[model samples]
Target chain A: MNELKELGEFGLIDLIKQDTINDHSSVVVGIGDDAAVLLPTPRQLQLLTTDMLVESVHFKLTTTTPWQLGYKAIAVNLSDIAAMGGVPRHAVVSLALPQSTPAEFVTNLYKGMKEICRAFGVNIVGGDTVSSPHGLVINVTVAGEVEPANLVCRSGARPGDVVAVTGNLGSSAAGLDLLTAGEWEDFDFAWPLVTAHLTPRPQVKLGPVLAAAGATSMDDISDGLASEAHEIAKASQVGIKLYAKQIPLAPELAEAAGQLNKQALDYALFGGEDFQLVFTMEPGNYEALLAAYLDLPVVKVGEVVDADEGVTLVDEDGQAQKLEARGFNHFRQEE
Target chain B: MNELKELGEFGLIDLIKQDTINDHSSVVVGIGDDAAVLLPTPRQLQLLTTDMLVESVHFKLTTTTPWQLGYKAIAVNLSDIAAMGGVPRHAVVSLALPQSTPAEFVTNLYKGMKEICRAFGVNIVGGDTVSSPHGLVINVTVAGEVEPANLVCRSGARPGDVVAVTGNLGSSAAGLDLLTAGEWEDFDFAWPLVTAHLTPRPQVKLGPVLAAAGATSMDDISDGLASEAHEIAKASQVGIKLYAKQIPLAPELAEAAGQLNKQALDYALFGGEDFQLVFTMEPGNYEALLAAYLDLPVVKVGEVVDADEGVTLVDEDGQAQKLEARGFNHFRQEE
Candidate 1:
């Protein structure tokens, strides 16, 4: 009886991977990647990814609408496709609901999912519905297509490449704080943060843009920046140096952080669920990519370094500190 | 606040489909089908489907091992691909487990899944693992491929088609009864029934055989025969006449039923989770198909009639009676 808490999430995943055998010749990339890559034809590669959102562990119906829950469910899965620089084409959703749930709530949930799927030109496919004795569970699987040449993986980063991110960070974490504190409506400035937590949008359109701009490596920022940076660093066998001042923080997050009496930078660095893109590219392509997304909010936050250098964060005073890979660990009791 | 019980499963599915819009040209078929059909390549059609098994609702951990649970989870999804007459290529599994669950339990679970995937040459590609506040949930999504010329849908049956079923029926339901009886170990003849309920094999090999033999309408029996029969009849706009005498029952099920003092015919008609293929083919093609599977157990149990005739069952005495679709309804309180 080895407790899951002793193994942790990553440890459990490693055990799962140990027994996984990729016997199919059509499998271009299998269990270790962000999305499973399959060569269905000579022309295109197919990407398959799945995500699960559990009640209480992922969300609470009291603070969130079924619509938001449904929207976020699909959005999170789409983020996986985006991480692999693929165009999401289809989605299948499986839901387990308590018998006490409302009929309209389920309908509204699908409406929310449909809204996101339609916005990205993805089609809702087949699904299974079953009754849960307790709690609500949503599992979404997204299938996408990518050209082999344009596909980006987390392992492609090289030393001296610049690390960049799309949109702002810490807003979702800040929003989650606001939701936890209650009375969020009293502070009108905190509404955006709250909405960011409830309905964080996946950066689907930005994936192909970065891939076309010669971005070497990319991953979605579902976990904190430090955690995701460690993933890219470990996968690419490179070190990363993040500049604290350069990390993008939403203005609303600053106000909310102030109201909560916390440092905004801490949230920007460690708060996750932003669903934004983090990527590395050659120094020369950084400016060109920035120029291309001039209308969008993109920023260079760091640079990839030699593997021996390790991952670190540089403060405003030029002090370098090791970046601890701390994020939400599902099996960590302390969390 | 309409209760889910009021909507039922089909009503809820209808609501879900109302807002679903297919936006991708590659999506040949989306929601409302047994599996979503996609033209991933011009050469092969892709079939995608998903199924979820939740704690207590789908299985009892006390009576079943994590390995059996995992095996059955993937097997059920493979059954969906079989229903569409496709060869499963890849699978992604997502699990939500409680922190208290044993790490070894999770490992053994994946081991079970790996065994089945390896046997079928299906790749266990990618998955997500997260902590649930309570209970264990497993969701499996399978992607399969089929040639357009060999594809089979649930709507292809017409009048004069013979309805046939592969393998034994009602054994799983009888197995469940034996499991609940607490002294199942005392009866050596009941071992097969118990194993059938614990690890029901999916009919993957038989699907292509039927499709190659010109089978028209086909579905895997997840719901009871009555419910699945209604599905094919409704989809094909035809009536089904099931012959009670022709329903194949395993000898062990008869012994178990005698011990339980219940009618074996009732379980044969309404018991579910058999994972056997129920299909219809032109009367001319039926004989050849049966001859092809002569070494295997196949039975011709019914025939398709005009839509106006409705679905019915002819008892041993040749009296026709309306077949009630009293299968497992997730939201039905009576279930």
Candidate 2:
């Protein structure tokens, strides 16, 4: 057996899928999408999503605390539920821990998770605990429910629906910059941004709210805006145009980007793990959505177009450039 | 900052649970049962189950092929769906692989899964792929659906309900013995048993059939007969009595156990990961249940009894001996 390094991440994933057996009848969609779908009963659907975060691969233990890791693990799955406009009911966490990890570190991690679950009313029901060969590996599975009428699939957008986002973008990416540069205190007051990057608060409340308000389609921003927009376009058989000028950038994020000689606007557009809700609405419902989120900005950055046009980003100067997805791909090499 | 080894698995699990928010309304039960329960939509019920198998913790890389691992990973989860009297519909697998693993090995694993999925008509829908810090970790979530009226739970058994098991028992454990002892020839013809241990075949077909035939309650025998019986007994608030003389043991298993001077009967009772369905049915349905599984032996093992009596196994001499749960507890060292 030659090393797995030779196969690369994408090759290994493709290989695994090739041998997978799916025998269940309730599995509406498996092994190929953002999540797995099953209609457990007539008129009721269940969505399950699981992700594994390993040390160094997904996070660095030296820089990331167990609490942040624990919170992020659950937050990511909750984001998946948010993407589907479903309410998360339960989560099972399986952890593989190193023998040397401190008990307090583990407890702190759970405390972070408890804080998040309390906000959203999600329960930690079951999980497995085993010793890891190396660092910690956390796999979280969240089960959520949706009525058929309220399910918001990524594929449901219309050509002319407006592309809007729940909150400001790029703050998380900017926070990562501060952490990487060892300047946590410089942006100490911006705890929400740092927490957004480390312990994302998924828009669980906003999902069903948007669905009730008649959003045409939706997804959570785990990947950058560019990547996620591409997904919606592909799924809905439409193209999307993102207005560069309309994307809001946090002031500190702008300063951080300037110091690094990078555009904060770019981060706002392409940085990932914001965990904010992004969805589309027709011209009619747009006003109510704006009214509902008046205190919190829901920026309308673009509009959906026919699929043949492809995705493009328009500058304030009216110059347009075609956008290709460049956000995180788990199978790709780490920076 | 005390080490994880001091806290142990249970302590760690409790720590993790304490940290979670656990507020989701869809979760009827979480964190402690064989599987979590979600409130079903009217006329339909959904069952979700997940299991993670680490390379060394669950299997020996040298002894278990990637193909067998893939098959078993999904099979075990399917067994959980079967336990709920649900028909499996889809599976999502999350895999963390070492950098050195071959793509071919991964592909072979999926090919084995494809074969099983084809046989059972399950769909591979979605999953995540990541680089492991060390050896491989495979986590699979299976989703299934059942009619609201037909779903069975561990808590539904009542006193006087007969305890029944599908097919023979202890073959898988016996086959594992052969694997450990390297007596290949003696088990050459017992591939079914070996496969039972290596690649579990969840009673997917029997799930709905048993539900339709009015199984009072059910659970899959993953943690051995005695342990699972104890679980059902505890949850149902009842006790159980087993007629040891009437317990069905595979012929090959009996011979192998006899050769090793081990009690084949005891192995059948306490060995784990059989993935067979152990259920209870009203005595009035016994004849119909027996006739329904005429092609496959459905052995009557015992009866649910009052909790005060506890669990007991009656010997051929008509003496009742107390049955202790000696099945697998992954957190505890293997005996």
My TM-score estimates for the predictions, one after another, are: 0.88, 0.80
Give the C-alpha miss distance for residue A45 in model 1, angstroms: 1.0
What are the candidates' individual DockQ scores?
0.19, 0.13
Q: What is the per-residue lDDT of model 1 for residues A65-96, given as tens digits with 9 covering 90 to 100?
A: 99999899999888878877778877777888
Please give, for residues B1-335, the per-residue lDDT of candidate 1 as tens digits: 33323333233334333312223444433442212333455576677888899988888887789899888998998887887777877777788877666656766787788778767766666677777877999999988876666677778899999999998899888888888777889898799988888899998888878888898978888777998899888778899999999999898887899999998887877888888989999988998876766686678999999998899999999999999987766766452
Output the lDDT of residue A243, model 1. Answer: 96
| lDDT scores of the candidates, listed in order | 0.78, 0.72
| Tens-place lDDT digits, model 2, residues B31-53 | 32212334444555555667778
Ten contiguous residues minimizing lDDT sum, candidate 2 chain A: A14-23
Model 2 backbone overlap count: 42
Best by lDDT: 1
Candidate 1's C-alpha runs over 4 A off are: A1-42, B1-42
lDDT for model 1: 0.78
RMSD of candidates 1 onward, in order: 11.4, 11.3
